[model samples]
Target: MIIKPRTRGFICTTAHPQGCAAQVRQQIDYVRKQPAIQGPRNALVIGASAGYGLAARIAAAFGASANTIGVYRPGERSGGRTASAGWYNSAAFETAAQEAGLKSFSLTGDAFTDETKARAVELIRKELGQVDLVIYSVATARRTNPRTGETSTSVLKPIGQSYTNKTVNFHDGEVSMVTLEPASEEEIQGTVDVMGGDDWQMWIDALREGGVLAPNATTISYSYIGPELTQAIYRQGSIGRAKDHLEATAKQLHEQLASGGGRAYVTVGKALVTQSSSAIPVVPLYISALYKVMKEKGIHEGCIEQMYRLFADRLYSPNANEVPVDEEGRIRIDDWEMREDVQREVAEIWGRIETSNIYELTDLEGYRREFFQLFGFETDDIDYEADVDPSVEVPNVSA
Candidate 1:
């Protein structure tokens, strides 16, 4: 099979195995060249297959020399259909980790279930004994409660009145107006249930109970608080409400583990092209404009760069005893993206952006390329026309 990107709206249905391997290698190479991190020796990364989660796993393994176990849900190739991009990504990552003599394992299933959690705990107890760092970066629209077996679905909508904003069709660079109606209370709660911190707390509690969480361990989860331009659709929206729950959970977890010198934090990250972000209304356009401004200023960063910085500069720096954080006790790695100068330029671009001048004013082309690249397409040196195998195995998958 010759795998190529097949898209329907924001979803990519096909992924190239070699291209995904190349993408993983690029991040690994970048991490290997940087100064080694004096961080965790054993780590567990939930949702460690794509986007920021994958980058965190790479940084922990290659940058800090940690043995890692990854939990993700990815479809494998079957019946002539290609595997999900995350599948290929995990396979590549585990292969590279083993080649480098670093212990790595992948467990594929619903991370929200008790069975999966129990299996992960068992793996940790048997293999690594104690994990010093836990990274929770799960992003999904739906979650099933392990306690109740009830499923909740998250929605991307504002909480109050309808929101009208300028958006772009990255497929064609067409800038237009999009109005998203407010979510109902039930819907907002549903979003919180799915995207909130309950599952993270459950994971931590299980790990601690299983005696696999190392003393003075640290746990981090990812979040986003974009500029005011995207407030209505993002920060002030239903997802924002979920983020509030997540941040609150961090505080609770921090207190729970405080007696042992353990810590929990919500790291607010920068905006970039992600499968989850692409689904939110008006964000793609904002990111396009943001990319243009940040690139011109030479401060643009993708997932790998941001994760590496989080580890090297903030988490494990020479002065890491006092990790830099904001008033709310959350790490603000999005500081550069939320810089005043960057926002000012993005605002100016927003005011004058139209379909006729979208390509001129924003980095829509770059956005499109990166968007495709998420599905293992648009990569450098890959012959998309060549025949390839769709069934690539994740060599270290367990349970």
Candidate 2:
């Protein structure tokens, strides 16, 4: 099959295997050229197929020389569709990890379930022995309670009143106004149940109980706190309420792990083009504007760059006795993204941005390129003209 990008709204329906592999390799190459990290020796990354989760896995294996196990729900091929970009990405990552003589493995299915958690613990015990670090990076629209079997589907909406904001169609650089209604309490609860830290806590409790966590171990889950422009739709929205639960869970788990001389933290990450972020109503426009400002200022950092720094700078800094955190005990890699000057400039553009000046005022082109790159498309190095296989497999994940 000669696979090309097929799109419907915010998702890409097809994935190019070689293009996805190349994307993984580019990030690996970038990590390889940098100084090695003083981080974890054994790691497990939940939702480790794409976006921030994938970057964290790459950083753990390549940057910190850690043996890693990844948990993810891979993309499926239905009729004419190709396997997801994450499937290709995992296959490529495993291929590289093995070629480089690093131990790597992956498991597929919902990371929100007990069966998945139990099986992951078993893999850790059987293969890697114990993990000193765990990165919980799963972001899903729905979750089923392992005990109750109840399903909760999350919604991205404001918590109170309606949220009206300027947005963009990065595909064609058309700016528009969107008004998202406030979520009901039920909707907010559902969002929290799906995206919150309950599952993260469950994973930690399972790992600790199964005795697969190394002594003095640490765990971190990814979170986001964008600028005030996005506060209504993001930080102060239903998802923000979920983040509140997630951050609170981090503190709760921190105490649980403390008995074993271990710890946990929530890392507030920067917003970029990701599957989850793209679905949010007003964030893409904000990210596009942010990209223009940050890139021009020469301080733009993607998932891989941010994860590498988290490990190298704060998480494993020799200058600190333990991982340093903010006043609320959360790690902040969103610093550059939340800088006052950056926000001020983005706001200036946000005020005057329209259809005509979108390209001039924002990085919508860059945003589109990165968005396509998420699905293994729009990469110059991959020949879209060539025949390709869509029935690709991740070589390391039999389970």
Model 1 weakest 10-residue run by lDDT: 314-323
Question: Scored by CA lDDT, what does every candidate get?
Answer: 0.93, 0.91
* Per-model TM-score versus the true fold: 0.99, 0.98
Q: Report the C-alpha lDDT of model 1 over 178-273, residue by residue, as the tens digit.
A: 999999999999999999999999999999999999979999998899989899878899999999999999999999999999999999999989
Q: Which RMSD does model 2 reach against the true structure?
A: 1.0
Which ten residues in a row are the worst by lDDT in model 2?
Answer: 390-399
Error of 2 at 173 (Å): 1.4
Off by over 4 Å in 1: none
